[model samples]
Target: MSGVDLGVFARCFPAQAPEPLGRAIADAGFSSVQLNLSAIGLPTIPDAQALADIDLVAVRRDLEAPGLRIWGLSGSYNLAHPDQERAREQTEDAARLIRRAPELGVVAVTLCTGSRNPDDMWRAHPDNDTAEAWADLLRNLGPLFDAAEEADVFLAVEPEPGNVISGTDAAVRLLDELGERASRIGFILDPANLVGETGPDEYETVLRDAFDRLGSRAICVHAKDVVTWDERIAGAAGLDFDLVRALHAALPHPVPVVVQDADPANLAAVRALVLGDA
Candidate 1:
């Protein structure tokens, strides 16, 4: 992690507005942030009206004022929700974000492949592996891909164990299906999400496999530890940061190592662990 760029999830800071939040992240020694519009009281996937309310210039000024910049925009709506209409709505919202990503100076928009459990997109369901779920994902994803193409932004999908794109194989399949449009898609690697219910014994193997298959296309890497599927900051749980750092260092191109699941109190400790400065 020594030569890697370090960032943090902006929402990890408690500030309700952009300026203070940027200050908080900079103070913690991070130079970039994966921003969620929710950090400024707007929906993550805002509608046209809400999107109109955003002041991209103000956001950029506020964040850069504190030496922090927006690296990625969180666009994580459920891409495969059982309800097609609800999923479509989320997709349209994400499309809006993708179109405006350049204005915010963000290079990518992050996504979740989603789940069939109507209540929570993060909860796993048997149907998540079914053909219909795959169809739902593709259907919802098409428009977002178009938006990415038109806006020249990368759609970085994060593989969650509970979602349709649950592992490296699924991720690979999706990329293959994208064909030429595959160039517009990249990945966000968070080793903790790959761990799922598995214990730390699977950490290195899982991390290596994921990188071997997806590392070259990685646009962002999440720094969090796993405790039997639970997520925490680096070194606070079971994940092996040494292996994580090695794989990150081996990436063909540099990507931000964005720290997640950390709050102000422990942010400094996580930063040190991520940078191998601890």
Candidate 2:
């Protein structure tokens, strides 16, 4: 079980407080964790926590009984909301996350591509393709990417099923648009996020292509077991861990993976399985 001090998605444990969340990672023998700021009502920019020094002194002292580390902090919000107000708020929030990135020892912050509808962060829409919608996403992210560069860390934009950059191709396109500046905005490739309910053949082909394009940009991935599309809303099967890890291992660059969709009750088991404990 050796990989980037791998950790679980703390947001999976919705019941725990921040301290307990950190403690859970420690108890699982994980060296680090990826905090989901949106899940816990913590925005990255201009938030109260960003304005003041994060009181992680308590977490630092209490969460570690033996050994533990905060690899990075995350504020995964919709950066491309169709509503100007929502986009403004979320874009501003990115700064708050960046402010805390230094103390958290994070080299990058994770983010979502964002939904087309301001009121719906996870729903798919047709207009997400509109130039205006894309412009909105770019208008905000451009500054944040620069800020992340200044922070000396990368801002990883993750592809989601219902967002502007839903698949790897778009992610690649976005990177191409950035040119050399793409180095500032990295990637958090979650295959499941890009995948829809598709046949195994389709899934494999799509995922392989996705990785081929963005593998070099990946800082991390979200490991999850998902069913194929034909299996209904929650059907299909999980890609073999050995296969998943093998795909990641074959990446041009190295990256750690957080099991984003795992259940909290089975963190240790799932973590070990994903990274190949044997």
Candidate 3:
């Protein structure tokens, strides 16, 4: 599935609304899409209420494109939140997608474990390492995993650097906490998310090591690249096709390597790259 059927978020294109975005994604030559579930209507799915607001037209198009059904939702919630009420709200948002996952015809729900900053969903916080942080994460994610189990789908946790479970180690700990249910909850590998000085080349080791430990739980991948900077690597402004090529070469197949992160202007380029036309 890795790069075999490249799909991008229609919203990433930004030129059109939700419906056209799917068409653009299809035109890009991706056979499947890891839908930014939020783009469909729900901002974040942490429950069923958000699912009710989803736009069905986009789903129809994706189905019509004859695109292979991959991840049908992106419920990127910050599971490791500091405030209890805010955390529950986010989870409730994410859960909406989980409730409706079956209808989407996909089994996995991708999510960001979330950072501590309430105002900034993308920024990381220092308390993300404290025991209280861990407790909050466990409390939130434990139930999310429970919901996933009930939904009969897998929850793919993206290890974003700014989020709580930012690496393989953190992910492993979550798995240990959940035990057998961990099988239902897995990692959605994003190589560039770990970017720092050495970036993926450095984190490539992390990726491989993570694969060694959690290969079984690796449900999908986020095909992207990060730019190496002074003493650390940050997410690159542009896409890196080689990153997908390298990851595809290194990992086992059957799981999809979604062609994500394409901007609206270059979405076509991502399609070309994924389909081997580039």
Q: Per-candidate TM vs. native?
A: 0.94, 0.84, 0.81
Query: Per-residue lDDT tens digits of candidate 3, residues 12-37?
Result: 55543445556666666666677664
lDDT of 3 at 214: 62
lDDT of each: 0.85, 0.68, 0.64
Candidates 1 and 2: which is better by TM-score? 1
Best by lDDT: 1
Could you tell me which 10 consecutive residues in candidate 1 have the lowest summed lDDT?
Answer: 227-236
* Winning model by TM-score: 1
User: What is candidate 1's TM-score against the reference?
Assistant: 0.94
lDDT of 2 at 198: 64
Cα deviation at 273, candidate 2, in Å, is: 3.6
Error of 3 at 191 (Å): 1.1
- 76, model 2: CA deviation in Å? 2.3
How far is 251's C-alpha from truth in model 2 (Å)?
1.7
Error of 2 at 188 (Å): 1.4
